[model samples]
Target: MKIITLTFFSALAISVCSLIGPTSRAATGIGDECNKGGDVKFAIREYDNKLVSVCRADGVGDCLYTKAFGKTFVDNRLHLNSDRLHDYVIKDLSGSYGDNDVTHFMLFAQCRDGNFVKVGDDFFTNLRPDAMDRTTGWLKLRVTRDCYNDSISDTQERSYTIVFDPKKRRYGPPDSNPKLTHYCSDAELALPVGSANSSR
Candidate 1:
């Protein structure tokens, strides 16, 4: 009886340790310790083995950090360019003028000195990874103009191709072909679906 009881206790201890180990580690995930103000919330994930934290200010729409991530800017759209030795973040920005908001996009590349350099900045409607050439450092973006203002002129949507120039260490100028205009509604241009409503 003594031998059986000791064996049972040993197995129970091993089981308990196994359950607690992973839970404790997961509870301490990267960026989980960062101090987010009362009005802000952050979601943390691992991209290319680095902690990527998406922080929202005022718990509302299109905060500056969110726009610096991408059009979708959510966890699903976050990507890492591992092909290049250094990591880079490509995102968009917006500003308010009276009742109108203007949005623009940019690219920031991490330098060897552990600082980021803004490599590209321009007006763009939407951006997404170009799967066909992402391994080669290419991206697909929707081009538009005056889409945010009250005026409806230059709201046409066009497709543009952008490539990363490793030698110059910056994204090259966009290449676009003249095409028929496609107008996008405000809802279509708004933040990614369910982003503003997400609890996280």
Candidate 2:
């Protein structure tokens, strides 16, 4: 009887180990890490007499912050939306198109809470000068597509405007000055695209 009991207990332990082994050994993918808020870090600083902040990885990795407005934190820079305030804007290179020798551009904005959030999509071609209209609180950006193409480089230019809504403490939908002529590649776009709506 005792041998039978011991055998039963050993079988239970083996079954439990079998159940836990695969789960423990399974690799953690990006989606899994992102859902858990991963390993991003955020820091706040003072820029233009306003509190500014950035959320990035400890090492070079994907950014996880999003959202804007109010006293909420999201990506890089944070600020409140008010006419008396200047929105923090960041222009940076996303990455290169592998060996294609093409670089991409990305735009980021600061929310009232001192976190920076990305604006619009990646621009593939030549980007005209970016400007912020202080009077109307509108940000204007223009970009040309396929400027590097060898055959007559059919460069199509498009402009976009982003407006801030102080009441809602957020920016309105992005509007294009000239509608897109060609479809931009969705591949290799930035991560954490939209607002996470997180207070953190």
* Top-TM-score structure, candidate number: 1
Tens-place lDDT per residue, model 2, 127-190, is 4434654543444443334322233343323223344443432344334212221233332121
Worst 10 residues of 2 by lDDT: 191-200
User: What is the TM-score of candidate 1?
Assistant: 0.36
Off by over 4 Å in 2: 1-94, 98-102, 124-136, 153-200
Worst 10 residues of 1 by lDDT: 191-200
Total backbone collisions for each predicted model:
0, 12
Candidate maximizing lDDT: 1
Error of 1 at 187 (Å): 27
Per-model CA lDDT versus the true structure: 0.40, 0.36
